[model samples]
Target: MARWEEIENEAPEFAARVRSLFEAGTNKTIATLRKDGSPRISAIEAQFEDGEITFGMMQDSLKLRDLRRDPRLAMHCPTLEPPKENPESGPGDAKLAGLAVEVPAPPDTPHVGAGFFRVDIREVALTYVGTPADHLVIESWHTETGYRRKTRA
Candidate 1:
């Protein structure tokens, strides 16, 4: 697994696109594992800074308990429809799969006893659709393989 900064260093363009989607909005969706091993989806806000991706949880939140037990997670950027005026206006939707590691909160953090976690990326992907041709495009990056892309009609 690699940090966001390492991905940026190894694959600048791919990293930039992923960063753009994360920066385009403050809200994203995350999936985590429930106690019984089922999936749980929740809305979350993440930060990409200082070479890492981090997110916080409210004190004693169920999500925090879930993360404490199982750190595996998948995050998807907000979905955006294609622009009517220009087909190329939308970059794409981004997704990331990673493990969350609990971290110490900064002294200035407002949420007392809140859980703070950093993402250790295992895979990252961008999906592009609704273009003029209506083809589906998927670009993916992995820790070992670097980057790969595919398109389908």
Candidate 2:
């Protein structure tokens, strides 16, 4: 598991693109595990600051409960439709999978008494339509494999 800063250090350009996608909108999607081992999806707002991806949930919220029970989660950045005339011009969508490590909230924080966590990234990926828009392009980085790219027609 690695922090966001490590990815920036090792893959600067890729990290920048991923960050851009995440910052393109205020709402992101997050998937967590329910108590019964089912998947739960929630809308969340994430912050990229101090070299960490941080998020907070309302006190005793279901998502917060899910995180407390099972920290493993996947987050998807807000996405936009690719241009029909030039799909390659789109910035693409980003996703990350990781364990959420609980952290102490700072003084006078906006989310007072809420649950706070920082991601320990296991994988990060960007998916986009390649030139000609005939195939999908996936660029990914993993803790074990580092960086790789794949395409699907």
Candidate 3:
């Protein structure tokens, strides 16, 4: 229900951590629903700008068709192994679940007939291990609930 921008404005600190995870790597993973109602996972690059998350796909891409049909999607930020010497420095991981509202192509667009969509985030979360005690922390934001935190010692 909320766009990335709204979350940022409402919960700046939590949003920063989630956005950092997304910015930590260029390649992210997206999950889409296949025509047969099964799940398909694909590599994608997304842009978080102008208070929205957007991505484009080549013409006739399965993911594109899937989004067109189902719209629902889940995306995850790329993960890195914890540093050998400093576990505290681990950047953690982030995930977004949302609906992809396809953007209408502009007549003069350069990518020919590529597909585009703006993410309508339903849930956003970041998971990390806290310092010292090393408890697992999961911080999440939702359109209806705002923000919540959970820790497992």
Clash tally, candidates in order = 0, 0, 0
Model 1 regions more than 4 Å off: 84-88, 130-132
The lDDT, on a scale of 0 to 1, for candidate 1 is 0.89
lDDT of each: 0.89, 0.93, 0.90
Candidate 1: residue 88 Cα off by (Å): 4.5
TM-score of 3: 0.93
lDDT comparison, 1 vs 2, better candidate = 2
Angstrom error at residue 134, model 3: 3.6
Against the true structure, candidate 1 reaches a TM-score of 0.92
Q: Which lDDT value does model 3 have at 1?
A: 88
Write down the TM-score of every candidate: 0.92, 0.95, 0.93
List candidate 2 segments past 4 Å from native.
110-112
Clashing pairs in 2: none
Where model 3 places Cα greater than 4 Å from the true spot, the runs are 106-108
State which candidate, 1 or 2, has the greater TM-score. 2
Consecutive 10-residue window with the lowest summed lDDT within model 3: 127-136
Angstrom error of the Cα, residue 56, model 2: value is 0.6
Model 3: per-residue Cα lDDT at residue 85: 79
